[model samples]
Target: MSQNYPNILLIDAIPFQGGSKVATRTLLHELTTEHQLCIFTQTPQSWQGLNARFYPLYMPRWLINKDQGIIYFIKYLLIALQVLLRKPSLGKITLAVGASGPSVDLALYMLKPLLGFTLMQLVHGGVACSKTNARCLLRADSIHYLPSSRASMVAALARYGITDMMFNEPRFTPMLNGLDKSEWPSEALMHSSEPARPVIFWAASLLKWKGLSILNQALQELNASDANFSEQGFSANICYIQPKNIALEYDEPEDDSANIHWFNQPSNLDEMRRQSSIYVSTSQQEPFGLSTLEAMAAGLCVVIPSDASYWDLALIDGANCIKYRPGDSQDLRQKLEHLIKHPQLMISLGRHAMFISRNYHAEQVYLPQLQVIDSYLGAGSSKAQASITGVF
Candidate 1:
C-alpha cells in the first residue's frame, strides 16, 4: 500500500449483520478505491467479499453479550492484545478508528491515543446517557449522527455538562443512510407492471421494538375480515432474524395461512424485495430505517408507521408512501386493504418512491462525509475543509 493512502480501520463488535453493519459495509465499499481499509470484527465471515484486511476477534456467545460488563471488557482486552502484539505496525499505519456507535468500540477508544488514530464516531441509534459514553463522544474527532438521533445525542451530552460550544459544526454532523444503486434492480424491473397478487414484504430483527407482533395482528385481522382472504388478500412474506440474548414478549406467529410465508434471515433479501410489490415497516421510532429506504429504492410501495421517524418525515403519505397510526394494527390492516383495493395507487406510489431514491444513492450522499474523513486522514486537499462547513 502507498504511504499517501490513508489507512482507515473500522471496528465492529456486533457479531450479526444488522442495519448498522449494513450501513458500514456500504460506506466501506464506497471508500475502497480511495483509501486502505481494514476491519476488526467478531464476525469476519459477514464481511468476506469486501476488499479489506480482516482481524478477527474471537468472542464466544457468553462473552459477546452486552450485559456481561467487566467480563466482556476483559475478554475483549485479551483478544485485542493478541492482535496488537502480532501487528505492532498497525499503531503507526492507521489514520482513523471508525466506530459504529458512541461506545461500540470501547477498546479502540481506550487505545486511540497510544495507537495515534483519529476517532470518527457514527451514531446509529439513541445515544446512551452515561459518563463513559459521553467521554468517548467528547474525544471523537468527528461524530456523524442521524437526524432523528440529534435530540437524544444532544441530551446525552448535556447530562455530562458538555456545553454547546464544545460540540458544534464540523465536530458534529447529521447524516442519513444511503442505498447502493448497483445492488438494486434496473429501471426496467422497477417500472414493471404490477404483480397479479401483490406480495406484502416485512423484514427486520424480531425485537419487540420492531413491532412484529403488531404486524402479525394486522395480518390476522386482514385474513379474518375476508372469508376468501387467501385468494383475494395479498400474499405476505414475513422475514425476520432472531436477535441473540434478547427477551421477546411473544413468539413468532404460527398461522397456517396458505398465503403467508415466514423466512428466517434469507440470504437473498434483495431478490425477495424485487419480487415484492409492497414493503411494510413496523418499527417504533426507528432511528434511520435503512431497510425502509432500501425498499423504496427497490420500487416497493412502502407502508410505514406514522411515528415521525426519519422515513415517516422523508416520505409523504399517498405520494411516496402510506402511513398508519403507530401501534394500531387495525389502522395498518386498513392501509393494506386500501392498497389491495387500489393496485394502481400502489404502483404509482412505488414509482414515485423509486424516483426519490436516486437522490439518496450512496456515492452522492456519502461523498461529502468521506471528504471530511479524508481531511482528518490528511489524504485530500483543503477542499475537504470547505465540505466540512457546507455539508451537514
Candidate 2:
C-alpha cells in the first residue's frame, strides 16, 4: 500500500519559519510513514528528524529583506536555475508549494511547465492583486486556501477578469490549519484547577500586524488596576518571537510589572499553555489562528479579537472564547478583567474550548486534504479534477 503512494516534493522557499512552516511540518510528519517525501527548504535544521529527504536551498539575505529591481531578479533567476537543475534528481513527483501567497511561490509556478509535475499550491495568507500572482494561481492544478483568504483570492483573480467559476471548480479547496493531537498536553493537565492567580498566555511574532502593542497596552492597564480586577490579581505569560527579514520602527518595551513574564521563543510553549488559565489572541484579521487553536486544545479560556477570522467566526463569545473589539486595547482590558473577576467562567470556557479543539485534530482535518493530493497524483488532470469535487 505504501509503495503505491505517489512521490511528493514539498517546497519551502520562505527564509523564516512561521505558521505555514509549522503546518507543512505537521502535514509532512503525517505523510512520512506512508509516502515518499522530499523537502526543499533554506532551514534544513528545522526539518530534521522528519523522514523526508531535505535539499538545502539558500535564499539570499537581500531577497529575504525584500530588495527589488535588477539585483532581485538576478537572484531569483539563479534560484530558479538551481531548482531546474535539481528537478531530474527529485523524479516524477507532485510539487507542493506552501506559501503565504502566490508571490512567495512564484518560482515554483515558473518551473511548473518545464518540470511537468502536478502542482499543489497552498496559500496561507491574503492574496494580493497582481498579474504575476493571478497567472500563477490560475495555472496551478490545485489551490488550497484558508476560508479567511477566499475573499482576497476572489478579488485578486477579479483583477484579471476571472470569474467566480474558478472557485466552484473542483481545483479550488478551502482548508483550515490543524493541530497534532499527540503534542497536546494531557487532558488532566488541561483541565487542572485554576491557579492562585490566573495565568494568561499570549504568543506570536512581534510583527506590527500581530497587535502585540495592543496587548502590551491592555496588560499595562490591567496591572495598574490589578486590585480592582481580581482579588489574587492576574499573571501573564507573553511569548514573543522576533520578526525576521523586516525592519521595525517600534521596539517592544520591557514590562516592569512583576506579574507579567516574557518569553523570547521559549522551547516549552505547550507546558506554558498547560499552566495558563487563559489565552489571548491579538492578531488583526489573522488568516488562521493556529496558536489560538492550540490554546483551545490546551483547555485555556481563549480571548480573541472580534475580527471575523476563522477563530472569531468559529468561537462564540462567553461560550468557548471571549471576543473584544479588534484593535481596541480598552475593550481587550475590559474583557480580561471580566474573565479575571469570574474565575469559574474561565474554567467553563476552557472546557468548552477544549471540546471544540477536538474538531481540528491534525489527522481529521488533513485526511481529506491528503486524499485530494493523492487523487491528483493517482489520476490524469481531468480525472483528478473531477475526483476532487466531493473529497473536500
lDDT of each: 0.75, 0.75
Residue-level lDDT of model 2, residues 2-76, one tens digit each, is 445566766676655578877767655655445667777777765655677678787666666553456645655
Which residue pairs clash in candidate 2?
A: none
Q: How much is 148 displaced in model 2, in angstroms?
A: 0.9
TM-score of each: 0.89, 0.88
Q: In terms of TM-score, which candidate is strongest?
A: 1
lDDT of 2 at 260: 82
- Report how far residue 112 has shifted in candidate 2, in Å: 1.1
Q: Tens digits of per-residue lDDT for model 1 on 325-392? A: 99999999999999888888988899898888777777667776777767776666322233223211
- Least lDDT summed over 10 consecutive residues: which range in candidate 2? 383-392
Residue pairs with backbone atoms closer than 3 Å in model 1 (clashes)? none
